[model samples]
Target: MIKHTPKQQELQNLQQHLLTTLHRLCPVSNGAAPPPPGEWPTTRQLAESNDITIYQARNLLLNLAGRGKVLVTPGPVNKSLRWYPSL
Candidate 1:
């Protein structure tokens, strides 16, 4: 079986918590899902809304994207990345 270091486990826990919080705060929790091709908020906005650091938000979203739980798209102009839940 695969093994996870202590830090890895801690990060995983944090990611789960963040995702749970996101689901609760967003429309996804109320059966009013976000638009399929709607615009997603920036990492900074997510961080602010979730009361977490930008780095933490970015890490959590990136982890979700890596797992195919979310979608990551390149932003126009500045070329930054934006994330959306896979709902």
Candidate 2:
């Protein structure tokens, strides 16, 4: 069997909490198709869903992406971006 250090276990727990929070904060819409699992949300979408200002959402998403907890995709229009949790 494999073993995990305390820190690794804690990290895993934190990731799980984050995932749960993300889902609760941004549930898939009724009768609307959902993205594949682990796919990130667009910056605009995230902002609207979380009810935060676009600037704050962008910064949060970028920080999550940098930590490897989330992935980011450039928006089709202009240079905006989207974010998803890393699978």
Candidate 3:
């Protein structure tokens, strides 16, 4: 059996909430066709779309990435990191 600390549980809950919010914003399609690869969106874009702070967006993406639910790509020099939902 796996054991999780209190902090881990809290983070898990936050991740779930974030996933739900993300799905509501950008739903996953269910059809014969799969989503295209390399569809990373910047944190700023997500923040603007969801009316959230950039910090919140970045943390959510990082937590999602930690759970293997998204991919994080560091942008070019001095650019903000971009995040993509795993398809």
Candidate 4:
């Protein structure tokens, strides 16, 4: 079995929580068809789901995206970000 440091474990927990939140927010999961690329939960909404601050949620999102567990794309308008679950 693999072992994890306390920080690593904590980060893993955060990643799982974020993924669950994204799944819950997915359009298809809401009894709708799949959404366009820009349809995703806002950073604020995600933060609220996880009970974390926006800045902290942003950092966690970036970290997850870097690891390919999540996907980050440009919004429909500005260069702002849109977050999605990659799993």
Model 1 is weakest, by summed lDDT over 10 consecutive residues, at 74-83
C-alpha local distance difference test of each model: 0.69, 0.60, 0.65, 0.77
Q: Estimate each model's TM-score.
A: 0.62, 0.50, 0.54, 0.73
In candidate 3, what are the lDDT values of residues 1-87, reduced to their tens digit?
Answer: 899999988767766655665566556676433333334456776777766688877897787888789766755323767655555
Largest lDDT belongs to which candidate?
4
Model 4, residue 84: distance off in Å is 1.1
**Candidate scoring better on lDDT of 1 and 3:** 1
- The Cα error of candidate 1 at residue 70, in Å, is 1.7
- Compute the lDDT of residue 11 as modeled in candidate 1: 82
- Model 2 worst lDDT run, 10 consecutive residues: 74-83
What is the per-residue lDDT of model 4 for residues 6-64, given as tens digits with 9 covering 90 to 100? Answer: 99898789878988898788734544544666666778779889998888788989998
- Please give the ranking of all candidate structures by TM-score, highest first, separated by commas: 4, 1, 3, 2
